[model samples]
Target: MKLLVTLMGVAFITLATQSQSIYSLNYTMGFGVGETSDFIGSPSFRGVTFEGRGFLDDQFSLGGYFSWSTFYEKLAGEKFTDGTATLTGTQYRYINAFPMLFQAHYYFGTDEYEPRAYLGAGAGAYKMIQRVDLGVWSIEENHWHFGLSPEVGIFYPVGMDSQLNVNLKYHYVFGVENSLNYSWFGLSVGFAWGD
Candidate 1:
């Protein structure tokens, strides 16, 4: 009876030592730049975003995001019609986008510290809009858009059960007149357990 109990205890300890995991929800703030601002001849567009991440195990994670981006462009050649300027100094467009991505992390070769790298892909939809405003006239065009994304990130443990994560991502949106494309930087906080 004593031997059986001791073996069971040892097995449990070994299993626990080998299988550790973490979970987290992160919010990111970053900016984006347009790929086609040159054609519009306006100021480059940019905006902020928010994202969330969760850990599945010690070396894997799943993430989702919702972001709002506003891009701006300044018109160089201005024209007038009906006493109203055809172009304004700048143009504004906004996108409401969502993305789902998965990542695999590696946490080896460190001095008992947890530092990892991850990569993943994403696909989602966007609510996009374009607007033009003259001194005496204004117009707006709104539609639904979709896109794909690929990203990578690094995670470093900072506390007994928490981590600091840094992410770099790129997205290219299609199905529109001018493609929606940008890169973003993200900082995230997460918590871990087990192992």
Candidate 2:
């Protein structure tokens, strides 16, 4: 993660030295839906994301983002037989995830206030914690995995230095085991500012 951030910093400096540029900060709120959600038995996982990017030109930009999300669910109380012992109770399941990525974007537009669209892809790491709790016993696991995201979106200019940003991205994480794979689709809305 530190290496990815360092590489992005180098790219930003390299780009800034070459042309007139802009910088932006954005916040996004969204829901996580898919295999990871299914694994936790909940499809309403909530996420918060923060990102910063440096635009070297009208068509190219580079940045990094950090996001966190949690998926949770509760199961009704029940009794089960575990070998010779019988266990009874309600259970809770939760999964927390943190993702950090380095991204590059390509925009299709002609001017600062003109409407534009972009396509981008990012690669990095994801840290996840999965846990299950019963009245008397609990289990928890953590893992770090390689991940990738592909995104598409539109930017609606709102001012000389700002725009409303909306996007959808597909996220995939390679798991230790095939069944541990994490896949989800996310949608977000935010704003970007430049100077």
Candidate 3:
């Protein structure tokens, strides 16, 4: 009975000593580099990211994140079939994507005032807007797919309640029709605020 009481006291003390941040909000803007398999040109993409996290413990956090990115490519004389005729000309292709995900993050090391590293993973919906322009004519389509993202990053303490954030992530969308599956490597830098 005495041993059980001692264990309960220790557990209470441990819980009381763990300090956690109430909430964290982060925003970043950057670019992604990748090419689609079916596209005829080498394309480039840019993105904006936003995240809001709540600390579950001193080292663990969970959050929801959303990002928007646009991909662009220009193709010269790409051939396509139109009924009984074949057409070829300069083509401009654009793909816009928005991903909303639920993320889990694990922060490593115990230094709150020093640079810290973290790894995270998320899965959610990816909404896509696809467009093609052939000078006088244009075609457009929209889709929604399931996707996942894996990330690694650093948090550099800049002030008492703010930090400089940098990260790299790989996003992949699955089960897309017409082989419109998308993937990219994203790099971003921004600021985070919390306790």
Candidate 4:
């Protein structure tokens, strides 16, 4: 995880020194799906995204994307069966996920003053931490999985150098070993600025 962050920092600095680039900071809301929903059925309100894109042409761009999301739920007197043991108690469950990816995007209506729509995809790694607490006992697991994100969004110009950004994204993380796969949908609203 530390290595990935360091590499992304270096890449960001390198990209910033180059040609035209767009950067954004977004507030995100995530809804768990599949196995993720099976573990924590509640939607995640605690999330954020940071992205930087360097233009390769009028319609194509390459970027780096990073996001963090947390999902939590509490169940009272829930029965949990693990192996031959059956436990009934109040359980507190939590999932924290960080996704870092390299992204590519294609834009439409770049020359127009109206909103520009885009299709983008990203591939990279996801760090997931899952925890459950039952009374005095707690079980936690951490895993790293390869992930992909596909999104559709629009950039609405708000000023000379800034735009209002909105996007809907889906994240899919493949399982590792015997681990379970995870998936989610995210809606984001933010501001973007660039040359």
Best-matching candidate per lDDT: 4
Estimate the TM-score for candidate 1.
Answer: 0.55
Candidate 4 residue pairs in backbone clash: none
Task: Enumerate residue pairs that collide in model 1.
Answer: 20-195, 42-73, 42-74, 43-73, 43-74, 45-71, 45-72
Overall lDDT per candidate, in order of appearance: 0.47, 0.72, 0.70, 0.88
Residue 60's lDDT in candidate 2: 86
Relative to the unseen true structure, what is the C-alpha lDDT of residue 149 in candidate 2, on a scale of 0 to 100? 92
Candidate 1's C-alpha runs over 4 A off are 1-35, 39-48, 76-113, 176-195
Model 4: lDDT equals 0.88
The candidate maximizing TM-score is: 4
**lDDT (tens digit, per residue) of candidate 3 on 9-111:** 4543443343544233344332443445365244344667877666677678766667777777788787889899998899998878777766778999767
Q: Could you give candidate 2's per-residue lDDT for residues 43-90 as a string of tens digits?
A: 534777766666766688877766776777887776779899988788
Candidate 4 per-residue C-alpha lDDT over 1-195 given as tens digits, one digit per residue, 9 for 90 to 100: 567656766776676655889999999999999999999999999999999998888798888898999999999999879999998999999988999888888999676257899999988879988899989999988898888899999999898889999999999999887666999999999999988
The TM-score values for the models, in the order shown, are: 0.55, 0.78, 0.76, 0.91
Kindly list the per-residue Cα lDDT of model 1 for residues 1-195, writing each as its tens digit.
235334434533343344343444445443444543432333223444444444445445444454554445445445435655453344333333333222234443333256766676655555556565544456665655555667677667777666665666666656565444433333333333323
- Sorted on TM-score, best first, the list reads 4, 2, 3, 1
Q: How many steric clashes between backbone atoms does each model show?
A: 7, 0, 0, 0
